[model samples]
Each structure stands twice: as C-alpha cells, then as structure tokens.
Target chain A: MRCFRFWPALAVISLAACTTAFPQAPNYGNLGRTPSKEEIQAWNQAIGPQGKELPPGSGTAKQGQEIFANKCAACHGPAGEGSQLAPRLVGGRGALNIPTPSRTLANYWPFATTIWDYINRAMPPKQEGSLSASDIYALTAFILYRNDIIPEGQVIDATSLPKVKMPNRDGFIPQRLEDIHDLRARGCGAGHCP
Target chain B: MSSKRSLRRQFLKNGAALAGFAAGAISSPAGKLFAADAPSADLHAYGQRSHFENDVRIGSLAMWPIVPGARRDYGFRSPLQDSMGIITPAPLHFIISHGHEPPDIDPREHRLMIHGMVDRPLIFTLDEIKRLPAVSRLHFLECHGNSAAAGPTGEPRKALAATVQDTHGLTSCSVWTGVPLALLLGQVGVQKGANWIVAEGSETGKHSKSIPLEKALDDCLVVYGQNGEALRPEQGYPLRLLVPGWQGINNVKWLRRIYVVDQPYMAMMESTKYPSARLDGKSRWFESEMGPKSVITRPSGGQQLGARGFYEITGLAWSGGGAVRRVEVSADGGRTWKDAQLQQPIAPKAHTRFGLAWTWNGEEAVLESRCTDDQGHVQPTLAGLNKFWGIDADYYRLPPATADMGNFNAIQPWRVSRDGSVSNALL
Candidate 1:
C-alpha cells in the first residue's frame, strides 16, 4: 500500500515537469513553414498605386506598337480599338457623360499604374505573366499614347508611369462604413437614400 | 423412428418445397416485376440515373458577338422556376465565368502564402490549412452584376424562364466551412499601418482584388468546404477567400496568395470593372455588401397552374445586413400586401424561406413579395429604387442609362393570367 501511494506522487511530479518544460513557446498549431525569399519574389509581382514595386525598365510607344500588333492585336484589335474577345483600350474620351458611355482606358481608368500592373499580370490573357519588364513598359506606353494620356514621343518607365494623369482620376468615391449602415437602414426607399 | 427415413433426405425435400413456394409467390399478379421498365444498361456503382431523365440545364445554342478562336463562353442557367427549396442542387447551380475554362488545379500542389507587412510570413499547404480550427456558416454569394439585364425596357424575351435566368440566376447560397481569416492573420501577426489585404487567384487571368483589412479580419474565411463536401472546382476548389455577404467577385476563387499591404492595390477589377457611377457623376467603388432582396420562385414565371384553386405562394428572401424579419406577399401587386409565414431557423445573412396560402380567383392577378430585414431595411420596388438613386431624365441620358442593374433589389412581380399562364409583370 505504501509503495502504490508513492508511485502516484511520482507520476504527478513528472506531469508538472512536462508542463514546465515548454513554458514560453508560442503555439501556432505547429503548422506551415516560413517561405523563402526566392519563393516570395517569384509570386510577389503585384504593383500598387504609388509604383512601389515597379521593376526597372523603359519603353517608347514606337517600340510598343510592334509588340502590340504581334502579341496583342489579335485580341485588342489594331490601334487598341478592341476586338470581339477583348475591350477597347483607347478612344472613348469624353464618353462618360454620353447616354451609352464606352468606358475605355482613356475615359474610365483613374490611375496609369493600374494599366501597367494589369498588363504585367494579365495581358495576352492566354500566356499571362509572360511579358518581359521592358515589353510591359512598352505596352503600357503604347496604350497610354493611344488613349492620348501621354505625349506621342514620351517614354514610359517606372518613374514616368505614375506621373501620367488619367481622365477619371477623381471619379471614385471610396465607400464608407456609414454609407453601408445608412443604406441598410433606409433600404433604398423612394426619394430616400442612394 | 417408425418410418426410419434419413434426416438429410427430409431436409432436401423441405428445401425444394420452399423454393417452389417462393417462385409461386413472386409470379403472382400483385407481385409481378416490370422488367421492361428497368434500364438495359447496368446501373453505376456509385449513382446514376436512367438516360430518360431529360431534365438538363439549358445551354445557349450559339455564341454571341462571335469571337472566333476565342475561349469558349459557357453559360448555364439554373432552373429557378423548378427549384424546390432554399438549397440549390450542386449540379444545377448557375455558373458565370470569364468565358475561359476553369483551370485544372491539383490540390496537392496548391499553397496559400500570406506575406507582406506581416511579422511572420507563412505559406500553408492545403493539408496544413485544413488542420486549423474551422467554422461553418451559411451565406449567399451574389455577383454584384447579377441582375444587369433587368433594365427599364425589361427582358426582350417573352418567356418567363428568360426573366428568371437573367434577373436572379447569378446568386446562390450554400453552407461553407473554413478557417477564420483572423486566425491566420493573427498567426502571421499583421504589422501596424496595414490597411488592405490583396487576394489573388491562380487562374490564367490572375484575377485579383484588394479588400479592406477590417473586412478581411471581421468574418472572411479561407474556405475549402462547401455543402458538407470538398469545394467544387468551379468554386475555387482547394481554397477560396469567402468574404461573407459581399459581392461574388470579392470572394476570389482558386485563391493562391494573401498580401497584407498599406494601400489598396488599385487592381483592374476594382478600378474599372465593378464600380458603379452615380447621378453626381462620381463613381462609387467598393459597394461590397449585397442589398436586401427577395424573389418569388414558385409560381414565379413560366410554370402554369392547371386549375386556379388554393395555392401556396412561396419564395426566397434575404438581406446582407442581417436576418430577414418579415416577408409580405401581394396578390394584387403593390396595392396591398399580407405578411407571409417565414420558415423557421432564419439565419443571419442567409436565404430565408417564406410561404403564403392564397386563393387564386379566375381573374388575372399580379403576385409579388417584399422582404424586410432585421436592420429595418425593406426591399424596394423598381420605381422606388430608381427614384431613390436619383436617376432622373438627365441621368438616364448620361452613360449607363440602363436600370441600376447592379444592387437592384426591386420587388419582383409575376402576373398570373386568367388562363393560368404566368409571366413576368411589366410593373
């Protein structure tokens, strides 16, 4: 009986020792590993509004015209007028106020960085993310020129792309929490909230 | 003992007699089997129906705009007119993609990386993510541009099926299970001053969108389970970011990465595609939450009532703000409405079933349903919503003169003719 009682006390002490062994360890469910820098660089290709992550490259509209005809015209059409598969990238200037606004890059886009970012990630739809940095800059320059946003001979690079002012730069009103709360309250009643 | 017959011989005689009796019973007229009705082909081991079940999804006979050599555009309309309850069958759920076929992704190779502006950047394989603490909730995923065809002129086609398909088919609801995004964010430890999180897909288009960090941490989920099963391929298979009660586009499918950032990415979709222009000439971006809406499914359109008698008018009602408090059904259009019986278990931000017993007279009548949510928001009529948005004569003359198809929650009207033909009401 004495031996049995001693064994129970010994087991309790061991359990306490086990608990104290890992006192300050943070539990992340011990799942998933930290990614390497190379892995991060390969996937972290998105460009923001301020051109923070833009790669170093430069291209002129003249260089971009050839690339556009060879790789993009099949979908975007000649002169970026658009085709059945893709949308028009140029023209439609001052059409936002018309009865049927043709929202092209010239009339609708607010930021030039978005144009470069979109093309870099999603252009040539089938073979996306396949364009070289210089090719992307050239395409961006060509599109901006076609939209009449930049001068004909101006070259576009990481620095100049963010400087180009778009037609609808001030068009959007960022939605606020109050707007959503109010919309829920009034439910878009007649002559009420919008 | 008296006859001295062997026990084995007696057993054989009894077995033969039993077999004969069973054959006689099976051959009786009452128990006759219609062998001809059985399919000639063998039934599948898992499950399959006979070829005679011709109830298939409707497909466009020909392409529109005729983009030669372009990706095939596949559009399937859910048979809403024939839907039975709140849960749409997985196969019949409506599909609206970017015309390109859904990329075939192997779940084993998929990885969800959380990086940028975080204390500890982490990449979780599909298996590792599934091992985290999970939650299940019912939510409705609606394309913000779902009812774009419900313009002032109405659908050009006279068929009621066309109206249902075009107006309300883009929305669907399901019970989803996944790890709360906040759980993952806490694990990575978001850095200070981070305002937005960009969710990117692995599709050919590399579709991506920027979402407010507040919204991402609130109730967003890294979902992999749908309707108690693995996520469907069309629905972002191995992983998808489910922004509950938000526009479908924000719920990026085939999710591959999450980037915690200091500013909105100004992606193509958010900048140009989803924003809607207002009467003031300024566009409204990030109209994320779906508005309160309701639709009459049964007796809605196309289906004709054989005899006008006691009929139960039933449909679906939901609101992004919260639970639906009440649903009112009107037999004479908006002139009058009676509160319908709301089905039980009315979950928040989910479809609520409602029904009303109506006695249909032989005279022509207009049927409609209006829903009010817990947030005191009542569903609006088309005219009411149009006026509320201030789309005046001049506004119509401007670009996007069509009805505010985006976020349109107008009361749907179903006109029942005297001859039992039901069609979409012009009102």
Candidate 2:
C-alpha cells in the first residue's frame, strides 16, 4: 500500500473498498456506509494542544467581561472565582506544588489551546455550543487575563491562542510506554501504537 | 393440591427452593404466602428480583461540593456488600456521570462515525455493527478513583466510616457482547502513524476520551449488549466502548465517534480533570489500568454479624494486568495470612470470587484480603502504595490537597468489633 496523507470527508465511502480492512476479523465486507461531510463535522470536533482545528474570528478580554457576566457568572461566579455550583476557572496561578493545588486553568491546564477547545465545544452548560466563535475567544481571553497570563487587550483567535503558553505546560509527567500501567509489553511504546 | 386448604393459612411457597438447603444456619427465605393469595400470574414479564432482594445503588449528589442545578455532576455506586458472584446486576451497575446524563437515541438513528487518519472513514448503524462477528466476554469496569480512603496525602475518596458498598462499589463486571473494535478498525484500514483514537459519546457534554490505538486494536470492543440482554440506557443503551481492564473513563458510553489521530487530544477530561497529582506537584497523565486489589464483602462494614461462629469471609478479586493468581485472607490484620479458595471460572480482567470458612473466635479481629494477579503483581498495602507514590506508609494525616487520584488500588482493611459489627479499619 502507498503511504500518503489523507484528509477525510464524510460519505466518501463509495470510493470502493480498502483491501487492507478486516485483518483480524472475518471479511464481513461493506457492513458500514461512508457518512456525509456534515455528519463528520457534527461529531469530530477535537482540537489538540496545537490549536490547529481552531476556527476564524477573535476577541479580547475587553469584549469578554460583558459576555462572561451575562453567560457564566451565575454558575462560575463574578470574575470566575467559582460558586457553590461550579469550579473556578481563573486564579490558582502558582499553586501546582501545594498538597492540594487549586486546579484552576492558570495552574493546571497544560495548553491555552485546550481552554479554547473546551469552551468552544462545551461551555455555558446546558446551552453548550451556542456561543459565537468571537464570544468563545473573548471568554478565553477574559479567563487568561483574570489569571494574569495575558493582558486584557490581547486578541485571542486561531493564531494567537496556540502561542499563549500555559503556566503548567510542563506540570504533567511525560507519557512513556512503560509508565502506562498494565500496558507494558503491549504494542504501545514511545507515544506510538505499533 | 393446596386449594382445599383455607386461604387464610400461609404456606411455604418456596419449599423446593428451601429443599436445596441442608439447614445448618439456614431458615426459610423470610417470604411466606398461600397459594390462594398469589397475585395474578403476570409472571413479571421483564422478571423482577425477588421482593426480598431490595439492593440498590447509592446515588448521592450530596458528595461534597454539591452542584445542585444541573445535577449532572454525580455518580452512583453498586452495593458491593450485598453483591454476589461475578456479574453485577445490570440495573445496579455503577455509574459515573462526569457532568453528562445518558441521552435518548433510537438505535436505528444512532450512528457510530469512524474517521480521521484512515484509508476509509466508515459509519455504522447499530444494526450494521451488530451484523459483524460478535464475541461475549466478562470484564470489569472500574473507575480510577474507586476504593480511595481518607489518608495522609489528602482527603481523597471517602471517609473511613463507610460501608464496603460505599467504598468499593464503583466497580462492576458484565458479560459484554459486541464486535471487536479491531474489527471496525480493520474495516476502516487505519492509516500508518496513527497511535491514538478519540472516542466520543452522545451525551450533552459529549463524554469523550483519547485511547491508545494499541488497546483499540487489541481487545477493545463496541459492545451493545450487557449481561444477557441489550445494554441498559444508563449503561450506554444501544452502544458503548469496552476497553477491557482499563479505567472506566476510557470506556466511553453511548459511543458516537472514533477519530484516529497521531497523538493524544488532551481533552478537558484527560488534561485538567483526570490526571493524578503526585506528592511533588507533578502529575501523571493517561495512567490507566487498575492494579491488583481485593476486598471482603460479606461481614463487611454496616452489616451486623449475629452469632458469628461459622461466618464465611468472601469478596471479589480482580486485576487489569491478568487473572487473579491467588488471594490471601488475613484474620489478625496483616500479621498472619491464609490462602483463600478462588471460585471459578477464574478469568482474566473479570471479578474472581474468593472465600474461606472461618470459625471466628469473635474477638475484635481485623480482616483483610490481598490479591496477586497472573502478572505476579501483588496488591499493595495502603502504606506500600503511599510509598510508591514517592513516600510514607503511616497515616501522617495531612488534609487531602487534591481531588483527582490516579489508580487507588490500595488494600482495604475492615475491623470486626466485639459487638459483632464490622467497620472500615483503614484509619
């Protein structure tokens, strides 16, 4: 088989079949169908630390203060100090080493892109995915600013979000094959699954 | 034959069931009914457990930092003290909500989309997935945070004054039925260099996890059946991922998407919430796989042992590494130990029942059980586990600083008080 980088779109299954499919199980050929691009877009919303999947549009904390107060303050509290119902989003900046470090975004999250991706996909609780891209960017900037990670005027978008390094970027133990319990001797090693 | 008798008189309805018992400490199952008083013979088409069996899971949103409005930040535990055998009743299986509730979706309409870093991105209807070759195997699903006690490192899981049900009930096993995920990936022809796959669910929060492709290709499954029937709504209903022996979060319920990628996605659950913080402040990520552990269920906490002369000590033992090789029970704390008989079929990655006849002298004796898996890893003492996490075996009692703990497989000790009552002895 030839090696090539393939960008996938849904419903593209009718391109015949992959001869290499079904090596372990019986050749129960053609059981599933190629899905439409819309179906793919509906569920495959993953954005890694690189923020490569981040979309267009941008906003600053100046624009976010209003959005957060209107949409988030009820559960997260004013200025994201956290409330009885929800956890804190900002502040907890130099506390990762404490016995019980307050895992606010400032001290725990390893990537700024994760914050953007999380808000974009699941924010405002029950009314998730309802916010505009600009609204999400503003909210992210507002959180970063509150944690003193970025200035209130810093514009956040696909480009700037990836560059905003996280405070606890190196807080996590690096992934190692032998380190993954019960996975030793399995095909996984050195961050690759062979 | 009893119709001629007076309807007012009661009869031993379960005489045959009672006949199976030889009658040492056994009494008729506390149920008495006359033939005439029997209810209309609906036969309970769905089949209900005997009214005498009222075991229920513990769902408490009141478990610290109560998030009231959404009610989504909650989970339920199985009644382990009341559990029997290997299979956890489908209805009583433990649940971890993780900020999302089970969604309602028709099996016909629900589709599992498999895309990204593949030669053929495929979508399978529930029927289509079911149409493939299927295998049924028993496996246990345990949360990483199961069985943690309040210890010196921090206020982790629970207070010492909790029942075995409350302490170790977050785990349950089932005979899951479905096609292997390798079969599905085999059909998709996974692209070279793809090492991880992000499994997403249909919940409102889209409950998701990034799993190693090695695991998916090994024994992971797209199961739609549990025990002997279709999956329960709470157990992912029409479809779920079964990552055998791994921590429960990776077994995404109501599975919807499988996006193969080159590296970890580091989603919110994986990045910020699930990592276990070490004593040194650095945390471990993706440290799945529950280690070898066992706990005595009977004569456990909350239950009173009336006349504990010939009480049998029994509980469950399991390991993510392999089958339970052996289980040793200790009557006088860890000072002495004796091998317990392991009930069959002693399968890997599933609950193995172990028990032994004990003529309790009925003093204030402490009881504990430790298991060694087929991989030869012995279950660690609470102190040994603490030491493994960098240091300490005694209860130095520092206020628990963090919430997320990695794999809490420490041995649990139960104290049998002189009053014939059992309680948690971890303190």
The model with the greatest TM-score is 2
TM-score of chain A of 1: 0.74
Give the alpha carbon lDDT tens digit for every residue of B317-413 in model 1: 8887778899999999889999999987688878788999988877899999999988787888877776766654343333333224356677888
Give the runs in model 2 whose Cα sits over 4 Å from its true position.
A1-25, A175-194, B1-42, B61-74, B151-160, B391-396
Model-by-model DockQ, in order: 0.27, 0.31
Give the TM-scores of the predictions, in the order they appear.
0.83, 0.85
Per-candidate clash tally: 0, 6
Model 2 lDDT per residue over A125-178, tens place: 788889998999999999999998998788999989989988887777664423
True contacts recovered per prediction: 0.48, 0.52
Per-residue accuracy of model 2 over B205-279 as CA lDDT, tens digit each: 787788988989989999999998999988998999999888899999999899998777888888887887776
Model 2: DockQ vs. true structure: 0.31
Model 1 scores a C-alpha lDDT of 0.71
- What is the Å distance of residue B91 in model 1 from its true position? 1.9
Best by DockQ: 2
